[model samples]
Target: MNSLENFSKWLQEEGRSSGTIKTYLQIESFQKWWVAEKIADRFEPEEVTVLDLQDYKQFLVQHARNKRGGRLAAATVNKLLQVIRTYFKFLIETGVISYNPALKIKNQKIQKSHNTVRWLEDKEKIRLLRKINNPEGMKNTWHYKRNKAMVYTFLMGGLRVSELAGLIIPDLGLAKRRLTVHNGKGGKERDIPINDDLFQALSEWMEIRKESPDEIVFLSQKKGKFTLQGIEHVISKLGEQLGLEDFTPHVLRHTFCHDLIIKGYALQVVAELAGHEDLNTTRIYTMPGERETKKAVNSLSMGDSF
Candidate 1:
């Protein structure tokens, strides 16, 4: 078999998802084309050269087409390059190659625009909560309560959807006003403080949650664990009812950060509370909009004012 087959087996052994493996295989197809068209038959792994990589880079830039019949995006090409580089590194480590040819390949720089954080305004938040509490909503009474609790947890604790979904009965410490998040992103565990609002919501939810301690904290109508898709669906439905645009769970997280920033909490403190390993990741949420910027500028004046 070829190197791609061997690398696919290695990725599987390393517990990579099938989707990831398939992406890698697609990248490998590009490399195989380079081998067939440019490199001679004797060009084995050890015999691969930097010139071969340069030729491959030219091919990618000039002729690479995605499945959509358009030129491959810079991001996709970059990912493909990363996969090849990783494969070359593995080959070097395993003594299959003396030098890593893929190391010298320079990826195209793709300019990324800053994403404005979508957060609920104070008025919008109040309106949403009021709508949830209204008794006249057509149906899905249990869903309203469950989703209210979900949004409350997100707003109060800044919990990621995955982290919230992974929560169990033991994770919640009502007495101490804390919850232990297990294996969050990058397998990091941290303690999140629970406020009175979240605690009260939890208390209310617990009356129903007591039926299954082994199950997730959030349950479906069938009393099973709440899937991520289910949580998203609830958010979408609520957004439609409230006439709000893009009201995902992540917006609740942004609201948590925005409220804290407005309350004059330090960025470092917010970052810790948000379970962000990098402070820069938390900084994105704290970015002020044009209105705040104009207000700040208006607050300043020349010292020579009569």
Candidate 2:
């Protein structure tokens, strides 16, 4: 096998999720750039230097344009740099490199205008659930139940879209009132307690769901496992009915985190439930929403008595 194939096997052995492995293998783009720039006569792992990485960073910032014809975002550049660092780390471990030259390099700073977490307000949540419960426009009762179960899993479980997609039959511990996320991001596993609503929805779906030969939890209408795009498309179509813009499963996830934090759940507890690798990510939920901020300011106003 080639070095890239070897690296992929190593990553799998290390329990990295498939998504992470795919992203890490994107180093091929860097290899192409290395050849195009004539950094080396050919792309050799041993010839890589910190200077070359620095030049590449400069290229990303000053020259690279995304598919939309805009400069690569700071976060995107940092993610690519992280991939480069990981590649070198693998090389060092395998004795192909003496050290990782990208060690001292820092990522570009990202500025925040406001909290980027978008979640449904209580009213929006109620409306969404009502639509799902009634689904008057939906003639297929089986799909309605399946979609409801999926949405509840997102809104209550705080599961990443990929994690939900990876769920299998045995992952649901209905009687125990919790579900196991065995293939979470970075391959970390965790259990999230199933609330009354989620449990009911899931139980109902399970009653009618046709058994998958692969033991998949959420099968598509065609009796195959649902693709990531298929899952997102299902949720997006629901959003359209509610007149919600860009309402994806991620919004439900954010709502799950935001609801728990605002209800006074401990930060550490929330972080673990959400499988957030960084506590700082969960802390974003603590930032008040626009409506909450407005309410806070309005509370100080003395009405007509003034």
lDDT (0 to 1) per candidate: 0.77, 0.89
Clashing pairs in 2: none
What TM-score would each prediction reach against the true structure?
0.69, 0.91
Candidate 1 to truth, TM: 0.69
Residue-level lDDT of model 2, residues 22-124, one tens digit each, is 9999998999998888756668888877888999999999899999999998989999999998888899998988868889878988775334668898888
Best candidate, lDDT = 2
lDDT of 1: 0.77
Superposed Cα deviation of residue 182, candidate 1 (Å)? 2.7
**Model 1, range 1-306, lDDT digits (tens) per residue?**
767788888777766656567766765575567668765553367766778777776677779887888887777777778777878876887678887878788987765433456788777889887876665854765665677778888888888888888888889899999988884664567888989888887877777557664658889777788888988888888889889988999888888988998898999999888888778667776677545667799879776686
Q: List the lowest-lDDT window of 10 residues for candidate 2.
A: 108-117
